[model samples]
Target: MFETIFTAANRALVAGLLAGVFLIVFANVVGRYGFGVSLAWIEEAARHMMILGAFCGAGLALREGRLVAITALPDHLPAGARIALRWIIVAVMFAFMAVLLWLGLKFVAFGWDKETMSTGISRGIPYMAIPLGCAIFLVHLALFARRFVVQEFEFHAEDTPSDRQV
Candidate 1:
């Protein structure tokens, strides 16, 4: 139940952010070229939205096995070796994300006093994407770690072999 909710919420958030960014950018472009007016804040808003969307979507990408990876070595390795390599990779990802989350928090704290030039919102608001993304990524990694290790890459939750068989 928790997993379903979390995944759904994460997907919604990412989709919303991306959609907002798209609409804003489209409007900005049309306004600039067609109407000969450009809102200064539009660029800043779009940039921040893109950052948030990319970061937030990362976990979903990982969970769906959409993240870019070089699978040549893992693909050629024996079953046990492939599994062992996956475990090592998972450990590295955990450590990397943990450090990123910590650093992101520190960065947010540092930016709390600062504000964006055009939007005038606290810079921490945008800086927050890092830690939030890392946390989400960590949760996803934890939830899917077993499947990732065992399956060695093809682990889309809805498209699993059992589901297909049924």
Candidate 2:
């Protein structure tokens, strides 16, 4: 139940962010060409939205095995080696993400006093994607660790139509 809700919410957020980017960019283009006026803030807003969307989608990507990786070696390994490798990978990922989350928080704090030139909002608002994305990735890694380590990571299982439904 919790997984369903959490997954749904994440999907909704990614979809909303993508739609916002599309709409904002479309409006800006129309305004520029059709009306001969360009909204100065649109570009900034779209960029930030794209950034947030990418970060927010990281967990979903990882869960579905969509993340880029060199699978040649892992794909050729024996079952026992594969499981061991997966555990090691998970441990490394946890450590890496933990450091990133820490650094991201510091980055946000450092930028809290600053504001974006175009949006005039706290710079920390945009910088927040780092820690948020890292945290989400961590939760996803934890939740899926057992399956991932026990079984070979399979993208097809996660790509079914039912799973695609938000």
Candidate 3:
């Protein structure tokens, strides 16, 4: 169930939000230069799309271990110490996610009362990405943490093609 839902959401966000933002920005640029016309709403709309994409994209990035990490510390540690540190990292991440979600909801509430300058849309709509992204980050983090606990290393080995394999 998790895999099914995650797959669909990840794909849709990349395809829709990410792609849409790029297209809108491109059009705005072209419209401004070629036609000498500025779209006030386009900028606002693109910003929202970017926020949504960043939040949604976070889950996939976490799953892929594409998020930032301090590799030197982990690699230098002994096996047992490394494992212990992994749990610590995951715990910190979850805590951060929880705070983000809690505070993000409040932010969204605050935004709901306000509107964008250009689009006149509720800022909450864009702020929604915070809590939403936090949730997605939590889910992916859980999956990765579970796998990390089970396998001491090479958590993403299955997802990637090893160079040595023929």
Candidate 4:
């Protein structure tokens, strides 16, 4: 269902980001040293690839719970309080994503009407990436919230460190 699709999207985004990094490195190195000449498109291509990588990677990070968080206080709280704190964090994240989504769409619309240009590409093309990324992030946040609501918060024995490991 939606979970499966989201998981697939996450994998795809990671792959694309990796590919972009590889392409940029290869093109820059080969063009500068081996060829003794630079391709005019190389820099622009790398820039766009970087933008795509960041936009897509953000959604994947959200899905994997790898985003930066301040949990020092929450870690010391009781179980109920910890769960409440997690929900509060999630709500704030959702609000932030919603604002990004709104602003992204507005930016795209402005670019479309203004008919801007960059790196030989229409400004709207690059602008579209913002909304696209925010939409994916919104979906990830919603799914994460749904799972949190259903499961509440369970402490797992597996999460604890063994005496030997400690």
Best by lDDT: 1
CA displacement after TM-score superposition, residue 62 of candidate 2 (Å): 0.8
How well is each residue in 1-166 modelled by candidate 3, as lDDT tens digits?
8775875777687679878988888998999999998898998898888888888888776665557767688789898898898888889989999999999999999989999898888889889999998998888777668765434333344555552111
For residue 107, what is the lDDT in candidate 3?
99
Q: What TM-score would every model get versus the actual structure?
A: 0.88, 0.89, 0.84, 0.77
lDDT of each: 0.87, 0.84, 0.79, 0.69
Summing lDDT over every window of 10 consecutive residues in candidate 4, give the lowest-scoring window.
Answer: 157-166
How well does candidate 2 match the true structure in TM-score terms?
Answer: 0.89
Clashing pairs counted in every model: 0, 0, 0, 0
Per-residue lDDT tens digits for candidate 1, residues 68-162, read 77889998999899889989999999999999999999999999999999999999999999999999999989988987777544345567565
Candidate achieving the largest TM-score = 2
Q: What is the model-wide C-alpha lDDT for candidate 4?
A: 0.69
Q: Which candidate do you rate higher for TM-score, 1 or 3? A: 1
- lDDT for position 41 in model 4: 65
Greater lDDT among 1 and 3 belongs to 1
- Which of candidates 2 and 4 is the stronger one according to TM-score? 2
Range of the 10 consecutive residues with the lowest summed lDDT in candidate 2: 157-166
